[model samples]
Target: MAYKFEVYTDKAGEFRFRFRASNGEEMFGSQGYKQKASAMSAIESIKAHAPGATIEDQTK
Candidate 1:
């Protein structure tokens, strides 16, 4: 896959997720969630919504 989502436990023992690029660089890291299911849900949400997501360029 050119892109992937990784789920991991942070130092504080919270479940976190990171989206990585094909080069293995992290594009973004999600906030810590107390439950793994929440983290998974977040990933799923991204998958479901990101395709049609729009860009709001605040720098304009």
Candidate 2:
């Protein structure tokens, strides 16, 4: 796959997710969630909203 979401527990034992590319480089990560369901919901929200997201390009 060109990209994917990975869920895992941190050293602190919190649930978190990271978005990665095919080359296994991380693109971004989510804040830790108390429950796995909350983390999954966050992923779904991103999937539903990302397609319509605009690039603000604040660096310009």
Candidate 3:
């Protein structure tokens, strides 16, 4: 796969998520969550909403 989501415990022992490319580069990372389920939910939400999201070029 070219991309994937990873969930892991941080140094602070909190659950977090990161989206990585096949080459192992991180594309994005999520805020720490108190529960694993919350992190999973955040991933699902991104998958569900990202398809219709628009790109805004604010750097112009």
* Highest lDDT against the true fold, candidate: 1
Candidate maximizing TM-score: 1
Worst ten-residue run, lDDT, model 2?
Answer: 6-15
Which residue pairs of candidate 2 clash? none
After aligning candidate 1 to the native by TM-score, how far in Å is the CA of 5 from where it should be? 0.5
What are the per-residue Cα lDDT tens digits for candidate 2 across 1-60?
689999999888889999999999999999999899999999999999999999998997
Error of 3 at 31 (Å): 0.5
Predicted structure 2: clash tally: 0
lDDT, candidate 2, residue 2? Answer: 84
The per-model lDDT (C-alpha) reads 0.97, 0.95, 0.96
TM-score of 1: 0.94
In model 1, residue pairs whose N, Cα or C atoms come closer than 3 Å (at least 3 residues apart or on different chains), thus clashing, are: none
TM-score of each: 0.94, 0.88, 0.87
lDDT of 1: 0.97
Error of 2 at 19 (Å): 0.6
Model 3 regions more than 4 Å off? none
Please give the distance, in angstroms, between residue 3's alpha carbon in candidate 1 and its true position after superposition.
Answer: 0.9
Residue 43 error, candidate 3, Å: 0.3
